[model samples]
Target chain A: MKRMKKALERVAETGFFLCAAAAVLALALIVVFLVAKGVPAASKIGLWPFISGTVWQPSAEKFGIAPMIAASLLSTLGAAVAGGLIGLACALLLAEVAPRALAGMMRPLIHLLAGIPSVVYGFFGLMAVVPLITQWFGGTGNSLLAVIVILSAMILPTMVSLAETALRAVPAAYREGSLALGATKMQTMLRVTLPAAKSGVLNAFVLSTGRAIGETMAVILVAGNRAALPSSILDPVRPLTANIALELSYASGLHEEALYLTGVVLLLFIVGINIASHLALRGGKGGR
Target chain B: MRKILDALGYILLWLCGALSIAFLAVILIYVLSRGIPGVNWQFLSTVYKPGLGLTGIRQIIWGTLGIAGLTLAIAVPVGVFAAIYMAEYAKRGRVLTAIRFCVESLAGIPSILYGLFGYTFFVMQCAFGFSLLSSALTLAIMVLPVIIRATEEALFTVPVSYREGSLALGAGKLTTLMRVVLPSAVPGILSAIILSMGRVMGETAAVYYTAGTMAKAPQTVFSSTRSLAVHLYLLVKEGLGAGEAFATATVLIVIIVGLNALASWIARRMSQRFTGGAKT
Candidate 1:
């Protein structure tokens, strides 16, 4: 009986270990497959030209990602500028000044915002936002401006929640001390509390930017999938993610490898953002 | 002068707060007001109609639920066991720290990367070829971090005293984890799974890449299928049925909101139960 019990225990332990190993295995498979499959294409295309070339014509053998990279950066920065302002303000209201009942209602609103699907957001942009832009500002309406607006809305929840958490983590003493020194309520929040929570708020910005940059399908539907340099916000631009999603189905040989190479660029963007956010989180921890 | 600035500050701050609420309200009202009228028995029950883009969507709903269900089946057991190993069985050391670091990094990865990997490995390399099983596996990988983190947290809160009491009563560690720790942590685990379910249901690009966009029920796990998310994407991208897009959006939003609310409610009730249990 004792031997049988020991055997059962051994089997359980092995099962648990294998399950834990599966996570590490997944991480391994992703990196290896991406690098192995992506690097050859980048090397074949010449890393410099592939990254900095002016056009991205796969059938014509021209594989440039400069425009896609630009669109991604522009949209991310635009969304950050827009979402950051609105989200920080909402965070301040939630963490500092709003009445308890109002804040309570607002909290779930933020959660609901987070829960709403990205495609649904895209559908709204397609039906509502695109029309509004075309009617008001002109152009075909599927442009960088629309992508930024939708991305800003999509990213708002993450920004607000993380920023609020950071704002709340500001030591109570900081706000009280500022108030006692004859500062007004707004002064206490803007000058004292927000400054103290700077790292956390900055972390929120970095993470939200990551989200905006990584978003694909929503942008695809709204951002006119024109693989051209966007001269202005009104001109439609194709980001790297949208580029891959639009073409990978039919791409083969060199064309296919180029898409994987595009994935490599995107992976680098995401990894950089993750590291920055992680460091920012660590910085916040140290400050607290 | 300072008072005027202060008042202006209050106005701006309140506007920002009110702005978020307004956005949420507008999105909900906009989708529902236009969508509810469009929804009917035929729309919800019919299969794909390519020309009109008017899908009955019964098959699409099944694909979403089936894929998400498969994800939970694989992820929950693996996540729970992994959490068990990390929290209870493993000793504190470099291995534990390494695993924790990997988990955190995995959480930071964007979903689209998962799509590329899913397309490359599952669809092309493994020859799953846009099948339900392939996308399910990819989604399971996508949501693993959520499950592991939540399960680990739940296990951490199980109270060391309970472990000690079980061990003293001559139950083995495995038995104690299964019999005692898991029972208490079930509510938290359920919330995590439900939240992940909502996320998987809402996912578009990854599933689009892994599961080919054919909005019909799979005859087998290996057959290709499209989820409601991808269906919505196609509907808009093709300009098929603008009105139907609203209807699909309404259904998607309702399910997602309901799932999230249920998860949060469960979490709240679980916390109350713990507090109440402690008192007793």
Candidate 2:
């Protein structure tokens, strides 16, 4: 009986170990497939023309994605800057100032914001944001401005949640000491606590930027998909993710490869930012 | 001077709070106003036509449920077992660190890339083609890490005392884990699985590649099917069905919010259960 029990225990333990390693297998598979499939296409396009050329007329056999690259960066930066401010303010309210009941009510609502599907956001942008932009700004409704607005809203929940966690992690002693020094409630929160949690705030910004840059569905709906570098916020522009999404279903041959290469570039950006944010978040925790 | 600055700061904070709430209100109000009128019984039960884009989304809704069901069924047992290993079975060492690293990077990988991978690996190489099974597999892989992380946390929340108490009563290790530990951890684990299902339901990009764009209910797991999110995307992009698009969006939002609330309530209950008697 004892031998049988030991054998059964060992087998179950081994099974769990194999189950735990499933993530390892999945990651390896993704890396292998992406590289084996993506690298050849990117190389065939010639690195310079692929990354630098502004024109993206796939039928003409010209596939420069620089304009799309520019649009992606521009909108991502816009979202980070705009969403960062609002998110930080909201985080401060939730973590530092709001009544417990209000904060409790709002926290899950914000989580639901994160839970809202990208397509729903896209629909909202098309019906609500686009028309508003056209009325106020006098250009096509689907433009960089619409993308920026939608992306900012999309990133806000992530930004607020991370910032709130960082703020909550700040030791009570720091706030107490600042108040002990006769600092006003607002002043202590703004100066002492904010400065202390700045690294975490920066982490929030990095992660939010990653979200904005990689965002595909909503940006596609609102950004006009014009394949041009926008001269202003109101001008239509196409980001890299949108280009891949819009054309991949029908695209074939070099056009197909070009879209896959576009995915490669996007994966690079996401991987880089994710690594940076992870490091920043870990470092912030250690420092705090 | 200090008083004026302080007052202004307070006002700014209050304004920020109101602004965040205002954003949610605008989205909900706009969607409900536009979409509620379009949700008649006929709009939901009939199949959509190619030329006539305003028919019911019943098939699309079924496809979404089917894909979500398959995803949860595959992902839960695997993820829960994996999480048990990480939290309870494995000793702390290099292998543990490697698994942790995998989860961290996997969390940040974007959905579009997952779409691309699904296309290459599932649709082409395996010859699964554009089918519900392929999409379900992709979604299962996409959400596996999330469920694993959540379940691992849940497993850790089970008190060591319970396990020891069962062991002290001469129960075997496996018996103690299955009978005593998992029961207490069920709420948290169940919540995590539900949340994963919600993610699979809302997923557009990952499934868009593998899930065929067939506009009707699938005949089988191999049959091509359309998801609600992709359907919503097509309706708006095609320029003819803006009204239908909003209605689909409303349904998607309602389901996603309902799932999120349910998962959160379960999570709250789990926490309360461990601390004291069930208060919620």
Query: Poorest 10 consecutive residues of model 2 chain A by lDDT?
Result: A34-43
Q: Count the backbone clashes (under 3 Å) in each candidate.
A: 1, 0
Q: How much is the lDDT of residue A34 in candidate 2?
A: 80
Model 2: C-alpha RMSD to truth?
Answer: 1.8
Model 2 Cα lDDT, one tens digit per residue, A187-223: 8999899888878888999999998998888999899
TM-score of each: 0.96, 0.97
**What is the per-residue lDDT of model 1 for residues B1-280, given as tens digits with 9 covering 90 to 100?**
9999989988998998888888888889998999998788988888777576546788898888888888889888998888888988889998888788777777766777888899999998999999898898999988898999999888887888988999999998788988999999999999999999999999999999898887888788898888888888888888888788888888888898999999999888787776775632
lDDT of 2 by residue, B1-280 (tens): 9999988887888898788778888998899898989888888898888576547899999999989988888888888888889888888999999998887777777888889889989999999999988998888888888888888888888988999999999999888988998888889888988888788888888878899789878889898899999888888888757778878888888898899889999998789888896554
Tell me the whole-model lDDT of each prediction, alpha carbons only.
0.88, 0.87
Model 1, span A201-231: residue lDDT tens: 9999999999999899889888997888899
Q: Pick the candidate with the highest DockQ.
A: 2
- Give the C-alpha lDDT of model 1: 0.88
Model 1 chain A poorest ten-residue lDDT run: A279-288
> What docking class should model 2 receive?
medium
- What's model 2's lDDT at B215? 83
Question: Positional deviation of A163 in candidate 1, in angstroms?
Answer: 1.2
